[model samples]
Target: MTIRAWPSRRLGAGGLAAGALALAPVAAAEALYVPEAEPVADGVYAIIGPTDARTYENHGMNANYGIVETGEGVLLIDSGPTAFSAELIEEAVAEVTEAPIRWILNLGVQDHRWLGNDYFQREHDAEVIAFEQTVRQQQAFATDHLEGRLKEAVQDRLAGTEPAYADRRLPGEEATLALGEVRLELQRTDAHFPGDAMAYLPEEDIAFTGDLVYVDRMLGVHPWSSVQNGYEAYQELAALDPETVVPGHGRVSGMDRVERDTGAYYEFLVHEVGAAAEDLAPLQEVVERHREEPAFQHLEHYEGWHATNVNRAYLEFQQ
Candidate 1:
């Protein structure tokens, strides 16, 4: 109902900042909030979030979640940051359908995707489903990073949150399900993250690509991500030719928009980073050089992640 963007901590120039924020209530200083739940298609409600990450304002509601009201029950796309955030999502879904949540498909293992799992399982007895790799990564997040790496940064919003993991693990292969009359498709793409998955409703011609596509923000590549693989993942998604593409962050857009933006980003990395690796440039020099490039210089919050992405791919190419 209320929304705004807020800033989180960034250690230094190289420290990554969460330019994105979650959708939450309007507060005194919070600016990045999830705008509102609106229908993008017949049964699909988009809880589009602020195109940022855990911030003081959003209270950690950065990731978007899709709710599909079906004959059986509601299908939740991804769990949010905390129990309170999930409750907000419940409010959004209630606006559309009163059916209880049946299942939740986690799109990735990021802090945003699975932390709210505890709330969903407790409230609706929903089964959390994710790719096998995602399940492992989720466990790692809980056991290793939950309190270690992320605690202080987001603890303010993670209050009521406990780690709830996936109960079902699906293979990272293309799979389809018949949700009543709506045809649902899950395609695995090892782009943004190893276990990243995308959901598509063929009947409605609407596709939800986890983080593989960012409409207007700087596309981040995880330390383990591959530019080559990420580019390939984009190609597969572009081929689907969906009328409306729901990106992991940012607004929903057409295929051409994402393909043009993200497609160009990866292409630049594959060539530039690959060349830097081949030329045996000093690691620090290569990272510094890429950060000043035309593409990296002008994107929304590009400095926060562009160098990291370039170095990760460069190291991969050298190996």
Candidate 2:
């Protein structure tokens, strides 16, 4: 699952350039299929998946979930996109270990994080844990956005199913949960979202970074006013030295690869967007010009989201 960082400009070569343009719309309609969980280290597993449908104002990439097996119980990281996928994850975990799933540490409050809460809670009595900010986002999603465009995109897959929201929250910089010999560390970060968090299993040298580190893709900018903190959030994640890095989306990779590739994407965004800002260019032109950047090149299939990311970066640049 190692992702090498290539120059964004090189994506123009071969059929990638034309293919990106052709597949943009088709990619948005497709839901990322869940991948089987694979062991990254002893007792630490990565739940990898394909690129999710691009619909939201943000959330351009799919997410990867993590699971840690310990003597006491199992610690599950971010839930998949829907309740159906979440249940599958639960069944998969059960196959390997009978220990109850004690804690579900949500890295953020997006659908990928909390929608699966009901499934885990009802079946394993697992506690849904997340940053306080994450809880707030969860409420916002439920009351405001979850049932709208978000639901419409995956309604077929969720047919006749409802997701349960969590009732509890974790607050501040750090929290630790002891699952047998493994200590799961949840560290708060402000990268992809206000409540963004990362989970680390020290004994296994694995860290599950929610959307904070988007591997092999463009980093999503926050849409809120005066917020360009996503880049800073990436720095915070780099500070946590882990051997294996499981991202919110894309393949799991070595810590070095995660840091290098994610950092490169951030730096590229800053440079490309900053240049556009300096020229006082419109958001669309900026996105159009940089469509060839490696971070965004493969995402030609997700052009619908380009406007959203561009708007976010444009606002941040102005502030």
Candidate 3:
């Protein structure tokens, strides 16, 4: 499948006010059922789900997740955002291999990243693991921000789609996961928030970069994000020089695509947005001005998230 950007649906009349949107948690993406799972390596498979909002149509499966067979059992990448997605993912994996699933590993810190934990815990007897920071981020931001957004995002899909957090977590550093014949490496990325972790499987020459490497999409940087750190993270990921990259969203890709596009986006944003904020350009003014720019004109969710990214960047500098 062609790697494309996710399209965000329109919000209600006037939407939430700009201020409300700012303070609100990340709204989810939309779609239905699980997409196909493609093999990244010999025994590894991934469903590179959409990067759109977790609305009804999207089925709360916007974030990508993967599977790796360890000769002993199966090790999953990030679980999807809801019980529905978790069910679809488990079914999808069974379609390929009958091996019991051993674990669900998280690649990002967003609430949606781990909400599928309940499914694996209840159905598969699997443990959901994430970085320690991922757990703290959930406790710090989940209770207030995510639950309602999830309730609104799922709608009727909310029936059995309970929110689940990571039951086990790794420290915020380099750690190797030994799953029999496979070894998965995990770490935070500079390209995304400090809490964002990218998983690398050196034996297979593949790295599930998670949201750290968004391919052909408008990435919303947190207000306190650092482009420089992103630059450094890219360098670190590039050093891995993997043959396959299972991004948190978008289709699984090669290292070359990750090196070229994500870095360019960061460079452009840091310079242009950084300049505008330094010039004391108000958030709305900067957003409007950039809306007229050529660089982001063709991006899939440009109208929806580009301005929001600018607004977040501006707010960071303002603070």
Cα lDDT tens digits for candidate 1, 23-119: 2234633443543677888878888787665665565666677888777888888988777577767767877888888889898877777788898
Question: Evaluated with TM-score, which candidate comes out highest?
Answer: 1
lDDT value, candidate 3, whole model: 0.70
> What does candidate 3's lDDT look like per residue over 1-319, in tens digits?
2232222222223224656545555543333444567877799998877767766666667777788999988988877766765676777788789999988887776655676778889888997888887677656655643466766877765566555667777875767888769988888773455467888888888888877777766666766466656766777888888888887667678876665557566666667777778888777878877766565555557677777777776665555
Local error of candidate 2 at residue 178 (angstroms): 2.6
Candidate 3 Cα deviation (angstroms), residue 150? 2.5
Q: Count clashing residue pairs per candidate.
A: 15, 4, 18
lDDT of 2 by residue, 140-218 (tens): 6654345665566665545423556545666677788776788878877656766777887777777788877766654
The whole-model lDDT of each prediction reads: 0.75, 0.64, 0.70
What pairs collide in candidate 2?
Answer: 8-294, 24-301, 63-248, 64-248
Runs with alpha carbons beyond 4 Å of true place in candidate 2 = 1-35, 54-62, 159-168, 222-227, 271-291, 294-308
Candidate 1 vs 2: which has more TM-score: 1
Model 1 alpha-carbon drift over 4 Å, by segment:
4-35, 279-285, 295-298
TM-score of each: 0.84, 0.76, 0.81
